[model samples]
Structures are given as C-alpha cells and as structure tokens.
Target: MDHRFEIFLACAPGLEAALASEAKGMGFGPLRPMAGGIAFDGTWRDVWRANLVLRGPARVLARIGGFPAVHLAQLDKRARRFAWGDVLRADQPVRVEATSLRSRIYHEGAIRGRIERAITEELGSPVADDGVRLLVRIEENLVSFSIDTSGGPLHRRGFKQAVGKAPMRETLAALFLRECGYRGTEPVLDPMCGSGTFVIEAAEIACGLAPGRARKFDFERLSGFDPQAWAQMKADAAPHPCDLRFYGSDRDAGAVRMATANAERAGVDHLARFECRSATAIERPDGPAGLVMINPPYGERIGKPGPLYGLHRDVGAALMERFRGWRVGVITTEAGLARATGLPFLPAGRPVAHGSLRVRLYQTGPL
Candidate 1:
C-alpha cells in the first residue's frame, strides 16, 4: 500500500497564510490554504516530519477515511465496514468526536456513540473520553474521519514549566517572527517577554533546532508506526552554530526567573538572555539592528487600559530613541493602545482570536 494520506495543519484562524508559506518553504507538497488550516497530500514519513518540523500549526491531523451517511443506520453500517485496523491499534484506547453541519445525521452525541461502538466492536479496542482523538465531521451528507496525529497542541513543546499571566504560545510567536520578516540571521528582542516565548523561539530557529525534538506525538502509538524510520528522521536534525543572540526583559522578577529557567530547559540559554527591567528602561544592545517583538498586556484581563496607554507610549519612546534602525512588531488587542504608542505603524493585520478577545499585530519599519 502507498500509505499516503491527506493532512491538515491547524493554526490560528487568521494565520493560515503564514502557515502555508512556512509549509511550502519546508517542502510540504500539494498544499492548499483553507479557512482555518492548510491541506496537503503526504505519506506516513511526511506526517512524522510535519509534526516534527512545523512551527506554526497547533496540531497535525491525518484524514483516514470517509463516506456518505444520511442517517444513523447508514452511518453505523458504513463505519463498521471502514478499515479501523489500518490506523488504530487494538491495545490503545481511543476517543471519538463528531460534528454535524447541514446533514441529516445532525445529532453529535448519537454520531459519536455509533462510531465509538463500531470501532470497539470491529477492532476490539477500548473507548475512553480522554484517549487519542478521532475526529468525525459530517457536512452536506458526507462524513469525513481523521486522527489527531499530534497528541497535544504543538505549542506545548515539552518545555517551559512556568508561564506568565498572558503568555504567548510558541507557535504563534514563531509565526509572528516570520511575519516580521525575521529569517533567523539577526538578533531578536522582546521587551515584555512573558515566559520568554519569542526569545526562545528565535534562538531555536536560528540554531536549526526542531520544535518537537523534546516532545512525543500521538502518531507514535499508531499501528503503522516505524521505529527505524523515526529514529533516522530524528538523527538527521542538524543544529547549526548561530552567532546572533536573543534577548527578553520583564519588570516582574518572578517572570524573569521563569524565562531564564525556560531558556535553560530549551538548551538555548547560552544564546538567549533574560532580565528584569521595565519596558521603558530597555536599551539597545551593541549589535546590528534586528527585530523587536512584544506581546504586552492588552488590559483585556489585567489592569485598566488608561495606564497602559502611557506604558505603550513609553515603550515607543524607548524604541524610537535607542533602537533607531530596528523594526518593531507589537501584538495588542486594541488599536487605540497601538496608536497610543505614537510609533509610525504600517497597516494592521486581521484580528486573530486569542482566548476570548481578538488581537492584531501592528508592525513598524526601521525607526
């Protein structure tokens, strides 16, 4: 058998284009950008590589099989005949989740129960609510089945035990770096580095380190897994020596400690430096100009927005006065706060759904 499968790279709603660009640069083939993700055709090896290398996708899913089922009876019958043994193992417990849209089989709970029973009865596997997830989507009378190849969200990265109040996810930080035209050749600075996400990600990218190197994936437990191939793939990761250094700073002492420990855990502590300093106190280091990215508190869940205006203004002043040739990327939830900075910002991107509030990335040319 060819063992080729259709794969979906899930990302934040507004970041599909950035993820597609990164995927294409990494050599994933036959790709199409969708509403919330990117779709592509690849084999098992490709699946493993994607989970190992992709930095922007929240998760990687493999479309296993599908069929047209208008009602419960047809769904049960078709699901029973599907090749369950091809992907799932009899010893591993599984979880089935279903969503219906514009289909006669509209009850999500009933659809999940039928698929769960079918897999258990046919494949002799146990069903658990928290086990590996198998997603079923019914749309316009067509049912599609996919397996969550990535166990947890890729942002976990198996590092950073401690986090700040509104820490940015590693995947989003990587995409933001790319959006700011960062190609891993120059240094990066994060004035409000919550848990050091941006700084660590920049160091990893510059060193050519794989994001999933320290983590495990759900695909390792599948029946089609090849240990020898996986070992070879992991061994092929080539980490290069980087001359550029990354920096992060925060006023909270505990946050600075967390960032330092996280950088140490990520094995990039030598290249990344963290400090406890207010944003306005940040000074440009002695080097060529690079990118300065910050995800400051947007007052959505924290303090009031009035005081943040001055904070943003002070940050803008520090950047404009000290770092004259560097570009800036600011992620905030309000346009007024960005405008308060008084920095000459270019046009903002679409609002991205981050938690309950929508956020946007405002960029600036060299100051």
Candidate 2:
C-alpha cells in the first residue's frame, strides 16, 4: 500500500533553497521550506526513492501520525489506541524519543515513559537502545511521531573509509555544489580536496549515480517492506557515461593517496583524478570552464596560523592568474580569511553549522 504521509528532508541551516531546488530537479514539489528542512507529501515508495537518490538532505523523516493530548492520561490512551502492528513488529525492539515545547506535558522523561508503556503494552515489544527509533514530539499540547527512515545520517554514503582532519561531509558538499549553481555538466576542481569529496560527488552526478545506492537503511526493518521492489529500484539506477573528468589537488601526498582510494571505493575513480601538489601550483584544466571549489582551514577545524592567510592569498593569486572564466567557491568560518583570497566573491551566505564552528559559502561569478 502506498500510504501518503509527510516526509521532511532536513538539511544544514541557511541552505533550504538549494535543497528545495534539488528536490524540484528530482521531480518532487510543491514543497514547504521550514526552519531546518523541506516538507512534502509521499508514500513508502517515495520515501525509499528519496533515501536512494537525494544527496543534500542529512536525514529523511516520515511524519506518521499524531493527536492532541492535554495531559499524560490522554497521551497514554491515544498512544495505546494507535495500531503499532501497521508500522512496527512485535518480535523486535523499538526505541522511542520525545521532545516538548509550549505544552502541558513538558517533562520529556514522563512523556517517554508513557509512550513506551503504551507501545510495550499494545505491541508486546521491548524498548531497547539499538532498536528502530520513533521520534515523539509534543508541541503545543499535541503529540506527533516521525520515523527516522535513513537510520544514520545520509552523509555517510557507505564509502570513503579514510579521511583527513576537518573533512567536509558528502551531504554538505552536494548542497554547496548546488548552491554554487553546478549541475554536473562541466568539470570541477577542488584545490584543497582532503579526501576528494567534491571531485567524487561531481563525477557521480555527471554519471547519474545515486548517492545511497551502496548503503543500507532503517526502513528495510519496518513492516510491509518489499525487498524485491527495493532491489529493482537499485538495479534500475544505471550510471551514464561522463566524458568530463573531475580533479583534486592537495599538498599532502597522504591525502592524495587517501582520495584516490576513496574514489575507487565510491566507484568514480575512473572519472576523478587526484594530484599531490601545492594549491599555488594548481592550474586550470583543459576543455570547458567550470568551478573551483575549496574548503580551506581558517582556524575553525585546526589552528588558524599566520601562514593560513598567506596560503589563501597564494591560492587566490594562482586561481586569478591561471584560471580565467572559471567560477570559485570558498568555505571558511571567518570573513577576514575569505577576504584574504582577494577574489570577487558575491555577498556572503548565512553561516552554516560545521561541527563546532559555523561557516559560510563564499561564491563568485565567472572570473
């Protein structure tokens, strides 16, 4: 049964427009953009497709059901009345979490206990740590539930076993690429590619490879999951030929090796090339003009030493001198470090949450 429900595609702060565009490109919409995500209508099959194809969203949550509850008694009664067999199984464990805001049931612990008892009593199942997660939210005296269908964060992508310090996530890389107006038609170069995230993502896009193709998900453990249909979906995602090759250059030879190995693991090594060279030595590639994207250290992930400014300046000088007609994107935590590039960046975007520090995407038009 293709029962329709709300699916929220959550993303990093300040990049909802880009994620919406990606969904629209994939033929999903009239979407509503919220504070941290986009909400749309879909069924289990749509959920599966979303988990399989989309690259920008960090998590895919299915809003299943909810009701108004002014007190714990009402919450317990309504929770027990809901049929858990339709969604969860009785043989396995299920994890329940809750949050509350502007509601009478403000205590999260009490809310969790009531819901847990209701589920255990109704479904005859135990609540364990590693069980299927059910998020219960009490907002304004109403309780709602959502299933984290993706299990782990979507950025894992089941590849890139090796990484350097302060590495960029695959989901963020894909969204940043979209925010920079990239559609995978031309080449892409990452001068500071730590593990070749941008280059590999670009290559996969150009070849039409699904990001979640190689990964497993939590939805498979739920009831009514059709293994045969999911297999067919994965089998149908055929990769197209991409003549354009993506490039990544790093001063660390170890980073170069790690990137090459990661590309191979991601099945895009043939279309991606990694070079162990300084950023100042990186020149524009042959053929069509494309993008120059980099995430340089600005004391956020590592120390912001004095030479960091010189490194940005030298990289900026190299791109300015060698790469004419190419656009650029630099992600940094501080505006001063971005200014050190001296590139004509467009107005800065809102600060994005990158671990402890928030960073912004500094983009430029064709130079």
Q: Per-residue alpha-carbon lDDT of model 1 for 171-217, expressed as tens digits?
A: 99899888888879999999999899999999999999999998989
Tens digits of per-residue lDDT for model 2, 201-291? 9899999999999988988878898999999998998888889999999999999999999999999999999999988999788988999
Off-target runs (Cα >4 Å) in candidate 2 are none
TM-score of every candidate: 0.98, 0.98
